[model samples]
Target: MAISKSQQFFESLWYRKTVWWLWVFWPFHLLLKLIVWLRRSFYRIGIFKSTKLKTPVIVIGNISVGGTGKTPLAIYLIELLTSQGYKPGLISRGYGGHSEHYPLSLTQSTSASESGDEPFLIYRRTKTPVVVDPVRARGAKELEAMGCDIIICDDGLQHYALQRDIEIVVVDGNRQLGNGWLMPFGPLREPKSRLKQADHIIVNGQDMVLEPDPIQAINHHQDAIKEPITAVAAIGNPERFFKTLDGLGYQFKRQSFPDHYQFLKQDFESFSGSILMTEKDAVKCLSFADERFYFLPVSAKLSKPFLQSLMEQIKAITHES
Candidate 1:
């Protein structure tokens, strides 16, 4: 699908330094801020009650519009918790999916169209139970009923309706906070001050000094095709993926699509040679994909100090409850 001109214009303004036309959206930004503040205040004062489940809930989310590795971070947490002997279940809002039912449980047979792409990817990659619902609290309840000991919310930092035990805010190291302005004027979903409230703040891809890693081995699948490949991403920030590929010394054309973009077979018909995409996008393409398509999965390699802090907090929360 073609991107709208208005969307392109605003994205440019959001990432670039302050431009004169940015003021045109200032009123809308202020309105958004008011709504956000009031909504948060209501939750805090009990006007809007937040449901707290018996099991501890850990949220991996961001304050910005685009991706900050929430899915990767969530997967990381799931693996970490499981290694620590916790049965962690995943929950998501299913952003780009529509279903006849609520709290749809995901399994290997579940299609990406039924569950959102990210949730499907998580289920496929981790083999963990995933539940999708617009009402995340309902999803969490389902997970708890399924014998999960802990819950890891994919992207719900601003979702005050479900009370969380640990809040993790993931930020893009390169794009930091994008003009530092809230929605309409910039990319932020919440004020920068909100970072202080999060139990942990993680920066994705902080170590640019790329060393030999497992990701490089995955790219070797393209060797079968002699022609140059194209790296296509239907994610929020495609540049980060491209930069990682560049750091790995791979050469390919870049094709970017809007976040959560639904893929059709025809989208790749014109392009030849191998195609690379993120795991999030790969889930949707598998039905129509072939040997020419390969996806590079990323993991959030968080610092040891951050991991220690997170483990400490989880211990305290679990002990207290």
Candidate 2:
């Protein structure tokens, strides 16, 4: 297969030379923000009204485009809520799915082609009701009908049609609002301070150095479990994966794929030791996975006191509702 220029560009976005190009792209990015501002203004003040589902919906997504570990965080939220006794379901836009108009409920046997990779990944990992549709509210309602008490919108940060109670912004801290600009010109899907809109900001794989380190750069790998081998990822920007691996001090071979990447037999073929895969990747890899393939879980982690207070807020909402 031939490599694409977009693929090559994205892969090398971290280089110092790429940093220089942001200056050239600034004007177009300004236009991008102007367009977003106009579009969101109607939605914000209500000309483009949003509908609410009866169930409380929490949206975990990023302002920047591509994989930023929202799926792992979504799965973690499902398990956390499920364990805490709330019945949770997930709703996603089903990017790359085959169907149109009609929403699909994920089953154990759901393939990536029908449900989209992320929904199938969520369903297989969480065993929570998972629904995928462009009409996010319809999916929420379907999951609600299935007795889900709360719904998690997997990646609906920009999908303004659905109402949400808690909004989480997931970020690759390494990229940190890349070139601090918007699409086609920079990396952000929305503005950076727009993070203030999120109920919480969660950073994944936390070891990006502002100053370069020789030894650290050599071993800046993610899948290699030098510490605990439980790794998990199913997103674009595998550099985030490597950065996380560095933070955990783990050593293992990498099994990275493109954003929304579907698993292949060769991924397993490449890694030999006990595998630690992102919860998102775990879904498709589950059949071939065993005890060795332990999935690591993560969720929104604000300041300690803040998180406790937020939990109380969630509890209050649940009780009052």
Best by lDDT: 1
* Candidate 1: Cα lDDT at 14: 88
Question: lDDT by residue for model 1 over 129-155, one digit each (tens)?
Answer: 899999999999999999998899988
TM-score per prediction, in order, is 0.93, 0.75
Q: Which residue pairs overlap in candidate 1's backbone? A: none
**lDDT at position 223, candidate 2:** 41
What is the alpha-carbon lDDT for the whole of candidate 2?
0.68
Question: Looking at candidate 2, what is the lDDT of residue 174?
Answer: 60
Model 1: weakest 10-residue lDDT segment is 208-217
lDDT: worst 10-residue window of model 2: 210-219
Per-residue CA lDDT of model 2 for 1-321, tens digit only, reads 112348547545632335665567778788989988887888879999788877888888888766666776777678878888999989988876667446788876667767777788677667888998889988889998999998899888888889889888877766666666676666777878788878877766442112212221111244423443434455676556566556756666565555555566566664555666554555556445544455553444434554576577679878767
Candidate achieving the largest TM-score? 1
